[model samples]
Target: MTEVLVVGAGPVGLALAADLRMRGVEVAVVERRTDPGAGTRAIGIHSPALALLEASGATDGIRERAVRIARGEARADGRVLAEIRFDRLRARHPYVAALPQSDTIEVLTALAPPVRRGVGVTSLRQETDGIRAQLDDGGEIRAGVVVVATGWSGRDLVYRPGAVRTHHYPDRYVMADVVASGGPVARVHLERAGVVESFPLPGGRRRLVAWAGTNEVTDADGFLRDAVAARTGTPVDIAGASTFGVRRAVAPALRRGRVIVVGDAAHEVSPIGGQGMNLGLLDALTLAPLLGPWVRRGDDAGLARWERDRLASARHAARLAFLNTMLGRAAGPSAHAARTMALRTALRGPGGEAFTRAYAMRFDRAARARG
Candidate 1:
């Protein structure tokens, strides 16, 4: 049997693979996709996750490639709502990096060699000693441990098909990421109509994620023009467009037998807080330490510690994702009252920093733990 089988090539799987390799553990990763991501979905790498990447000896590449947003803001109508500076909030990694999910994965895959693409896991059986997986390629692989990073694809392995639990909201957002050829774009810019987030990637290309509407945005050009028009009263062009749904789902536990779930598989969230990938990254830190001894001496204490120590954090990540999504859709009388009071008390003054810091993962205890 192999040391470990990681069942996805996404960021979570690759990251876990990297951590395992760093600890001198043999690992193999499988990706169902034939290639890297087509567009940018997950953006904004926070300070905590940056530290994790740094520890893994992969930070220099990402740091050199990504654009830094010293601060971020949330706004409404024509009035400026809240502007919080991430650089000043925490001292570790002073800025938020704006990069695409593809670039992030690319960096990670390079660091972690031998990711099997176009390979899908079909079935998994676990015993007291190790686990075995069936690949759609009509092959079998055995490992002492297997991590089910397959995302929604692995739901059946844990629960009945279509039985995964999820919480969603009515509000939706349209997103687009493109290379701005003109000049260095604004670090973090948001208007009442929506928000524009930018992060530079390797090869002089920058990634941008913009949310132009709360409801279904019909006209791509119109939304771009309107977003710029509403914010700056000027015209702007949207060179590329990509749109996807926003959702939140959390499994009760991240592990069943030797098969463990991480990243989008264990928990997924709306893009409101930009914590989805970061949550998965944290999974590496929290779970990696648990697998070292298991691989070194064929012991299970390290693996058990991984589950025990990481469980609460995983649940909290899902819970926070839920709260952030709900807060994004907060409306009607109750939401209005809350937002209004928030605007009156916090958003208008220095208290505005508190709201921003809380969301930026700055105000939390030990915010540098890969989340």
Candidate 2:
């Protein structure tokens, strides 16, 4: 029997499986999709996440394929409002590494246990000694522990008997990849009109994300081109475009009996600050060490501790991400001015380092512990 059965083969599940296997635990991973997801998603890999990737021996490969961003700038009306210098960060990997989520998944998948593709856990029931997972393909898996990393799909299976609370923001974002001529500084333009963000990706490609109010954007390329040119005075050659909604949710608990949740399964935050994937990666790193004892001794106490700690950390990270979304999507002259001034003070004042550290998620005990 597998010691642990991971129900999703995304970055979170793959990271967990890799960590567990490295620790001598027998693990299996399952994914519903036969092929990997395409496109560049979650472009920012913060320092803490880089540390976790290093532990799994995946950072070197990822670094070779990622762009290193030394600082992040917030601007309005073509003027810089605030700057967060990631170069001054205390971590070993100071700068945020900009790589496509697909590439990150490739690195993790290479290090993880071989995943069973086109197969998904349909349902799970806790047994006396282990959890029994019903697969979509008429197969069943029984493992000492089951980790549901399906992120939002299997919430009904893993949430602790209570409804998960979710707050959906009115904001929508149109994102696209573009070829631009600029330095490697990640930038956010909080204009009175909308929010436009640019992050340098590997190759000559850069990712641009712009807040598109309630109106549906029919032409993403035209929209991004106008927005990027207007906000940053930088010309962009649009490559591809997509849209996504902004929302935040957290399960009441991260553990249910012999099964636990990680990544989007446990919580979700807005992509404003690029915290979602990094938070999930940290979840895998922090949860893996606790699983060793639970698998060997059936220690429910350790699982309980993991649940409490991770939930708190997720809440904290989600709050930060929400704040970022609010600042970026600030509308109207009064709100925009207030946000610009606040950000300027926060970034240029004595508390700038603390603010940047917090936003970068360096203060999380789990992240610091791994570092």
Candidate 3:
């Protein structure tokens, strides 16, 4: 029997599998898709996440394909409202590494246990000694422990026993990667038009995200160009475009019996701070060590502790991401003015350092204690 069966070979599952295998735990990973997703869903990897990846020996490969962003600027009306100098952070990777999520997936998949693609967990049932997962291909997996890292789908499939609350913000945004020449700095513009943000990716490409109000944008290319021009005072060539909603949610619990959840399977936050992937990586980092011990010794107490710590951390991250979305989606002259003033104050004082550190997810007391 497999020591651990991880469902969904996304970043979280892959990271956990790699960590557990490195620790000498037998593991297997399954994914529903035969191929990796082409979209660049989450693009920013912060300092703490970089540290985690470095420990797993994946950061060098990731950095080879990623662009290092040294600073983050907030602008309004073409004026720089606030600046976050990532260089001020004390970590070895003081900058945010901007890489396409596809590349990230590649790096993680290479490090993880061999994945069985086109295989997905259709249902899960807990037995006396382990959890039994029914696969879509008429196969069943019985492991000492099961990890649900299938993102939002796990909310219904795994957590149906309890209520999961999701708060959808009225904000809608369109994102695209375009060919552009800019510094290694990420910028966010909170203007009356909307919130237009840009992050530099590798190979002279930049990712642009712009708020498009409550309505679905019909012309993503046009909207992206106009928003980019309005926010950065520069117009560039568009490569591709997509749209997404801003929402926050948390699972009722991170663990149910012998099965556990991680990543978007357990919590989801806004993309404003690019914390979704980083948080998911942290979840894997946090759970892997505890899970290995629990599976080896049948230590229910250790699993319970992991559940408590991870749940609390997820809630905190979700709240922070919601705040970031609210600040970025703020509109009108007064709202913009208030945001500008707040940013100015926060960036100029000690509060600015705290904010940036928190955004980087380096200020978690539990994480520090664990380290």
TM-score winner: 2
| Candidate 3: Cα lDDT at 254 | 82
Q: Candidate 2, clashing residue pairs?
A: none
Instruction: Name the lDDT value of residue 34 in candidate 1.
Output: 92
Lowest summed lDDT window (length 10), candidate 2: 153-162
Query: In candidate 1, residue 367 scores what lDDT?
Result: 61
Point out the higher-scoring one by lDDT: 2 or 3.
Answer: 2
Which residue pairs clash in candidate 3?
none
**What digit string (tens of lDDT, one per residue) describes model 1 on residues 156-188?**
766665556776666555455544442333333
Per-model TM-score versus the true fold: 0.83, 0.96, 0.95
- How high is the CA lDDT of each candidate model? 0.66, 0.84, 0.82
In TM-score terms, candidate 1 sits at: 0.83
Candidate 1, position 139, lDDT: 94
Per-residue lDDT of 146 in model 2: 92
Tell me the spans in candidate 3 whose CA falls farther than 4 Å from its real position.
369-371
Total backbone collisions for each predicted model: 2, 0, 0
